[model samples]
Target: MERLINLNSKKSLTNEQRQAIYQRLLQESSNGKLRKGSISDIANSYAVCTKTISRIWGRGKLHVNEESMVDVSLKKSKSVGRKKKQINLGEVKGLPFHRRSNICSIANSIGVSKSTLHRRVQEGALRTHTNAVKPDLTEANKMARLEFCFSKINRSLSNNDSTFDDMFNVVHIDEKWFYLTKSSRRYYLVPGEDEPLRTCKSKKFITKFMFLAAVARPRFDASGNEIFSGKIGIFPFTTLEPAKRSSKNRVAGTLETKPILSVTKEVTRTWLIEKVLPAIRAKWPQGHTGPIFIQQDNAKPHININDSRFLEEASRDGFDIRLCFQPPNSPDLNVLDLGFFRAIQSLQEQESLGTIDELISAVQVSFERMGSRELNNVFLTLQMCMKEILKVRGGNNYQTPHIGKGKLERQGNLPLQIDIDENLINEVGSYLGL
Candidate 1:
């Protein structure tokens, strides 16, 4: 007889345990002169109810072997329980477009609960995406983008399989307006902690400063140590003037800095000559003695390439630098616009600033705090975007490609240049009538 265990315990018996009990009962019955209460006696010894033993014996009798022992199936039948509810995806999709905007609305239309629709979303039957307005590209813009990408290909080594040139000689410059603070901010706090309060005269009239940022591709030696970080500088569009009247914060004749709200051709030219050139001259890698291209967007306020003052200053200091314009309506082609500006903006927004000086300092510090590897990755992304543009025949309708940069960098397999498909290049060239 088996040892007696707790019958009131919540734990259920396994199939093997139940089978052993049945076999023992059958063996006892075979010994002859079975008692009238033999089933109850066995159930009491096994710590199971009499009804459970009776059911097991009933199932055992249905599948008796040659030796008169039960050999019943352990697994339950598939058709024994209730079936799962089925959802008609076609009916759900056929609902009005506005009605299918959210789970609650869609579920109500389909006569299902929101939780069921949420489960489908979790299972990838539905996806959530944020749409933004993309620039409308004309035929000329598309062809220009294609030509720009083609110019970056390094075909001197091998014409069959061309690769992109290392963009160390190219500097990406752009202007971005950094605001004092966002209207809405999110924060995490302890249960009993007080919420942070911030105020502004008007959200629409928040203090903002426009800054011009310039960056080049970082250089590394054979040992993988960065020799030149390629951070030229970030200059703010602000000017200082003395206070003409007494105020609570300051007295008359006190020098106060104010942002230059309107940027013009003259302002752009002045900063490029005074601030941008000097910084590039100071930070330019000594080993690299080649012409540098300062790439900018086709903004009207930007200085023209043929500006005599810029050309004159650019040719000085033993540096061959020139200004070039990227394709219009294509912000993805610029490294700064691709991701660097947003990275620095996120860091800058973390600081508290009450004055223009503090804002400028915060932005400059954030720009310097950014890692060179991140900037390098943005440059790589620019190349990948170029490849995508070529693939789509210069149409910006494709998603950005993720090449697992982190994993590749960890394995020391991160490539300096991405190779362009020869067939793609030829096909794009033929399509462009080049």
Candidate 2:
């Protein structure tokens, strides 16, 4: 069926559409005039009268004769939209956070129109940010964070720009809890489809499992080939035991995988000595030789970096695998906490989990499913955060810097190491009395 275009009503052609028409007319023209019915054909295709097409062709030809760009844009001025209302950001900043917490409150405080402020927000001129309260840093914590970031820099000056290490040998380990289901979840459903109904013993008693994740900076060869994935493994804190008594869900003597409700220093040490150590030694890049560092946070349940048991297992098979602690109260310093854990958690949430076994499998699948490139990006972000840590003299008050790692990777130009300024190094070093 042939569709109809309303000719009486005004039709607005975008700049690209007008330019396309002009180029078509130029192609079909013999000298100045179009081929016999070229105008009619183009008009019918665009659903515009021949007159509109002729007018455009005339203006385009005039530009061709004058050797200028086609003036196909509407004659209307660019200032066609409503005049934007401007608010003094300085004044807004001066107001207390509570006063400018919402658009209505901000407008009332600054005496600006609420609708205008909302429009600005909608246009992204202004943003509504929800900032969680950051962990308070004591003077001691600041110094520790500064020293940790400083240790990351390679003082050898091997390159023109002194940069942080590639971190290929350092494995960042962290613990996270994955619940069977979120207290609240979002789902897309077909029209008239019934929403999913979920029941739980209690939201507080939701099935949860703790996991220890270990990841190193992924390795890439000279030609950008993947040498190592950097994914050592993610270990779940679980125990397989037989059900002592018969239950509605399971028969007696059936094997059940249960989560260890509480994580302790002893259990964590056991995992490091038994699971984490073996996985690292087996998966460590064959050609790469170095004192591999297992960087972990200073949690209460974590064993000391020099734990005798950990050292005993880590030193096997000519490998100098060692444990080290990142700065306390600083999650950004660890690559897993910086981004990898969050990435895997989001993927885990997408799976339908009903049992503890399902949760463990889901978390494991999410861990293995993540690409090495993403893990490398997290390590790069870790270096960028270190730079920010030094900038604030060890304060965690700045936003994480994004250097378009994905975009750079797609362009085959992702950086292996982020450079640090010498002045910044000296300034921070002197402050730390190093």
For all candidates in order, the CA lDDT equals 0.86, 0.86
Collision count for each candidate, in order: 0, 0
Cα error, candidate 2, residue 69 (Å):
19
| Residue-wise C-alpha lDDT for candidate 1, range 1-434, written one tens digit per residue | 33234445434457887888777767767533345787878777667767677777767766653456565434565476666456788998799777877899989898988888898888878777665678999999998999999888887456776888889899999999999888999999999999999999999899999999999999888777999898999999999899999999999999999899999999999999999999999999897776899999999999889899999999997889999999999999998989999999999998988888899999999999999988888888999999999998888998978898888888988889988888887888798787
- RMSD from true fold, candidate 2: 4.9
TM-score of 1: 0.81
Query: Residue 271 of candidate 1: its Cα lDDT?
Result: 94
Off by over 4 Å in 2: 1-9, 13-95, 99-116, 156-159
Global lDDT for candidate 1? 0.86
Q: State the lDDT at 75 in candidate 2.
A: 77
Candidate RMSDs in order: 6.2, 4.9
Cα displacement (Å) at residue 246, model 2: 1.6
Among the numbered candidates, top TM-score falls to: 2
Model 1 stretches astray by more than 4 angstroms: 1-86, 91-101, 156-160
